[model samples]
Target: MGRRRRRKPKWVPERAIVGELDRRGRAVVAAGEDGRPREAHVDGALPGESIEYLRCDREGPVDAARTLEVLEPAPDRVAARCPHYGVCGGCSLMHMDPDAQVAFKQATLLADFASHGVEPERVLPALRGPTWRYRRRARLGAKLVPGKGKVVVGFREKDRRFIADLSTCEILAGPAQGPLADDPGRLISALSELIGSLSIAARTPQIEVSAGDRELALVLRVLDPPSAEDLDRLRAFAAQYELRIFLQPKGLDTVAPLETGRELLHYGLPDFEVELGFRPTDFVQINAPLNRAMIARVVELLELEADHRVLDLFCGLGNFSLALARRAAQVVGVEGDAALVERAQANAAANAMTNLSFEQRDLYKEPGAFEWPGGPFDRVLLDPPRSGAAGIVEHFEAIAAPRVVYVACSPETLARDAATLCSRHGYRLAAAGVMDMFPHTAHVESIALFER
Candidate 1:
């Protein structure tokens, strides 16, 4: 008996072109289907590019079309450097020019600021670094596809949760297995080959990749334990590449080195004469050069005086706090993660930073819950996550630091928190700008200084 064939999706306007880019950098396509103007977003498409995509029968909150073909590209559109551009969800702005990408991110940040009824007194130039191979940390997805008889390792698809078949990645830092140069081609392929040879390839769900100045570590998340042969292969693979290999059976605390003599993942800020140690699961800035530049900018903006006391909130592993300690008289770094707080303390001690102190406090909770800190600080630095520093913004009087610098990963949340600070805390948005922490993606990392 013959089986029913799959039906094609009901895509509209067989001939359509993207008119412009939206605030989020998405390509916006306006089409008049059945004489009614309809709008939909085309993925992997640049503005002024003609494209073809699948449109389902019913539209979603934001109608997203996939499998796009750029018939006539935009003037500013450039060929994607990554071979797995469209399939891999790691990057969405590779087709757009790098300078344009930075501008788009800046515009996104500024628009958010304007929407929240706040504006920066001065707009700083976008902070940028190398356009390629800047990502030093990533959690790659792993899956064993049926019939393929091998493991597929890469980022998930742009529209789906399935892993993209990736042989190499351009944005990711190359794992230096031995003495050879950092080659992107060998990194993903070697990881794929290693996992495919394992008995528990299907049971492995993730590979947490992180690279420090001299160390590149991979932590394999295993659902089930591997056999004796699997351990031999893993150990050999680790030794061959001279890569730090770790295994995680369940929780993050369970992650351990596969072999002995594993050193703590380390990086250094030469400008500040500071070195930091971190675990593979710890949150560090993806772009090292850009991070150093950012810390410099933050220090310059704060105009840290030798007699001033500074507060660094959400200071993970003392990345900024360490740098600030080099300039400020006293620096107090607070983070919610106890583990990171401990790491920060160790880093401060290792650097012989007597002026810096590390503390653990959930900055997201009520500010009155804790005995806060010795504040009325001269300067305050907030490096919050995507949720922003909403909880503490209300009780700004507790710290009431005259000068506050906020480093944010989310522009919308930054704008929201800026509104709270300006309206209630008597702070003015002094200066603001973005940093290309993750290029070729919509992720915007911005820094703002507030003055009272």
Candidate 2:
């Protein structure tokens, strides 16, 4: 008997689809012969704007597609500033007007709240700042593509595993006065060959970029020890660009500065009169102006007094804790990471803030699993991650704080926690609004106030 022949996978051809944008800015439509609904999140398409799209692939019921042509452009649609807008995945909503972008974010937040059967009594004005050149921190991908004969350094390609060849990054804050400002790509191209010489270049994934008001630092994540020549080249590159270079052979603990007796990187909170020193790997907000704005807003909402005691949960580097300390009689910060807790304490001490104290504890643990100190305070502040503070909210009654301010990065999780607080804990949603921490991206950072 002849051997059975193997069947080849069928080729799926791209087809035109018309769709309208939903709340999340994705185009929702029914395409193909079956007429099933599919969500195509094309970057440039906006709500009420009809567009032609080419279906790329399907994930369950949704068909991922790219905008082939905008048959009818939205009134808010504008030209994107970045030359690499479509190819680079860094900024998704650049084509939309700035005002429209914020409106979309507000609408999306409201939709998220509605989904969870919660709504704020008042929607605060959206907090916004500089739209371009606002990013002070970024993790850039680096790869030495031998076939291309050069290194590609930038963000990843749109929906692809490969890195985008970026000639310039409009959103990234460039050097004040140097060639780097004119051609930021030179930073990677100059070091491409040197990085290729290293044995771990294949495994080295990324170079972390951290920029302060005064200095820019690059942390190279290396998988293996560098040769003597490699070190020399790195030092030379640092000296030439006036940048502080750090080498990381393993984890965050392994990151070290190449030059001896170098000053640490810091950003100033001029309004609060606080200066925060942090390592390259430390977690700091990417946008400086917006962070300062957010902090001021938090202080205003807390209505802190000299006799009031406050609690700050998930406090990192004392960004909000130190500021709260200035207004409140005393502030206690709690964090899960020991390193961040230590840093927060050091920052408080450096600022001569005797009213502030920090402790390291797993905040997500069960209510009685871990002991919380210096709580049952007058006011409480929680700046949780994207996962939200479910663990803390589960035990909110134990703290019994009258007013609670939640700074959240995810609306879905925030809505979930809001539902828990309002429905279960008898707290009312006073006000909520979105902060434009990352412009041109779908990321939403927001703050909400709750009171009983």
Candidate 3:
């Protein structure tokens, strides 16, 4: 007899059933197409290999098991370098392609508007900067382990309470890079020779590296006062790096120099020839390039003219006021912090700007008697903190500037405030778009132009 040919096994179409059986007695569990009980399958069976997913529909929640396919990665899928990408909460979308991530953010804004019965005619393409290693500010948690006899500083892990063992964070800017990245554990161990104990703090824990046009400043937020030996090591590190070191002990009030002979720590805005000096604990935007871009965008939105007067709300150290003074007839900056107001005034003087003024006001609180700079003000620029300008929206409405440009860091607050301004104040959202200020993180920085 001729040799019998064997038939080739057919390829399964993802939902194919492996087998079926009948039970004469006893309870029989619903079987999946892979011949395994639906609950017993792992990875939910290979892709294309049967796995029925039963849905409650038509028959009203039947017990019969149905085969379903496994979920696959999205089309824009790309590999991320961080070991803690999915598990670590720090960078939520690092796995996504950077370009796609920007597009997704833009799409989200469009979706938000479409739902609100408004469509923007133009959206400036996302103002993108270096996507990776661009963070100039970070607050790191400092934990001391007795076994290790040192401090561990970095961002915490997503799933676990403990910090991730990261040596170099790709998300931090180059100036913010630490020796720890080469060998984090070993580096912390070495630092023990100088420091005593550590505890939780802000985003970038040990050395807060604020960027500038010329020099860099490293502000160290020490939970406890540094020991003599520690100070010496730090001084040596400063000398080695040729960096200015500021010690922050308790709070913003406690930030000062260790041994002063050198110049004060300040970052420069060369475009406006303005220098801003801030303590490490003070709030400053993390991304420098984008910050410059944002400030420029705010100025451009103001549509400044030689004779126009402008108001800058929550003006921190005259960032916008000075920029406005360059073009407008006069600029008034109002801030809640008296110290910041003083600093703003000093900054104006430092830059030799005459048309800028600063005032201290608790804009968030209902003041019994308050003063507003006399104005038929041509335009108003507001950059309030995350809480939004809820307390002063009426005053803003009262002023009734023909144009208002708002720079916001929170979308929900911005949306609420924008809605109020539009419905109550009669200003329309003329243009708005997200800025990639804090990339790889969920933080959204946006700007909007409102016109009557």
Candidate 4:
């Protein structure tokens, strides 16, 4: 017995392996029957081209064996036009099929309040407009590269520092007037030639291209002071492009027109014959068509009347205030920024809207004490930022506006404030709905009508 004969393990043939070689765990990443990751599995499958299936890592109470449930069609839903749609992380629901987007947003509003045991009389239809290239304002990021002999400008990659090497953005309505989405590098090169560094900012990640009813005012964010040659280059480019340029040397306080003539960026509410004069960096809605729809929705919700006195809080450039003034007897717009108030006043005057007046008062700090032109409004419209009007929720009760229209960009904040309105302020959640302002994005823009 030669050291108690040891037994060797037999080798299993590769052919005996189970499943395809590319199959990894629960997901089979092999090319689909056609190609591309399978139409994002409407069920548990992940829509990706990798051979590995990642484990569910989402926190909270997600069922381990949960599967996705597809809903019915919505009229507003459509196939997202941008190729950079999913990866850019800017838009979320692009693939959801149009009308579905509206349904989802509507459902989001309903779900927000169902937990709070509140319901509105109606969940209105989602407000919609052109689905692609509708953004009128965009703030594209810029970076200079030494070896590339130029710079790069566009939105940052989804949740990352790097920029998406995109050529065209169909969502930007004014893309045609500027460099095509695929060619942002051209804009970067132009700016690099004109200045040491350059950046662009607009309400949307896309810049407004057309000098439509409004002039094309571009805010060129600078990292350092431009040299004289740089200024001349920029001036010439602006002249050739027929665009107005503003320089941001420091914080927003330092923003000013590089070349000031009588030219103005004046967007219009064509339906109302209202011409709104806005400088670059003003908080105008990026989608002109959607803005018109939102205004119409607000007016419809407010049931504005000649005798109605409305208070628009956080009113930027009097978008809602002027619209309210057209119908209401008096409209008081309050804002935290003095510069915006001045612009709002100018816009009101330019439109010749007699009943609206704007005031500069911080709602979060000096919410109630500041003297406003009109008081005791019959209705109040609140368009606070993502933080919601937490500091002023209580003031709503004291003011006793018969109706309140809260336009919110965040649903969690809307729900929180809605709770306050119903629970603490003795107001009823009358109606709530979502607007497709930023479609394909997780950002939810909501409008909730409250009655006291």
lDDT per residue, candidate 2, 196-218, as tens digits? 66666776678888877677789
Model number with the top TM-score: 1
RMSD of each: 3.5, 3.2, 13.0, 10.0
For all predicted structures, in order, the TM-scores are 0.93, 0.91, 0.75, 0.76
Which scores higher on lDDT, 2 or 4?
2
Tens digits of per-residue lDDT for model 3 on 354-389? 898888889878732456776668898888888878
Better of 1 and 4 by lDDT: 1
Worst 10 residues of 1 by lDDT: 174-183
TM-score of 4: 0.76
Candidate 3 runs further than 4 Å off? 1-71, 83-88, 111-121, 147-150, 174-207, 261-263, 367-370
- Per residue, candidate 1 scores C-alpha lDDT tens digits across 1-452 of 89988675555545576666665567776756635355677667777777776654335445666534667877778889988997788998898899989988998999999999999999998898989888889889888887786789988887565888898888887444453246754677788889999999999989988888888889999999999999999988877777789999999889899876774888889999999999888989989889999999999999999899998989988999999988888999899999999999999889887998888988877775656577669999999999998888878788888899999999999999999999998999999999999999988999999999
TM-score of model number 3: 0.75
**Which structure is stronger by TM-score: 1 or 3?**
1
How well is each residue in 52-120 modelled by candidate 4, as lDDT tens digits? Answer: 222222223211111222133223335556767645544555655666556656766677777667778
Count of backbone collisions in candidate 2: 0
Q: Model 4: how far is 335 from its true place, Å?
A: 1.0
Scored by CA lDDT, what does every candidate get? 0.85, 0.81, 0.62, 0.64
Model 2 clash pairs are: none
Model 3 worst lDDT window (10 residues): 19-28
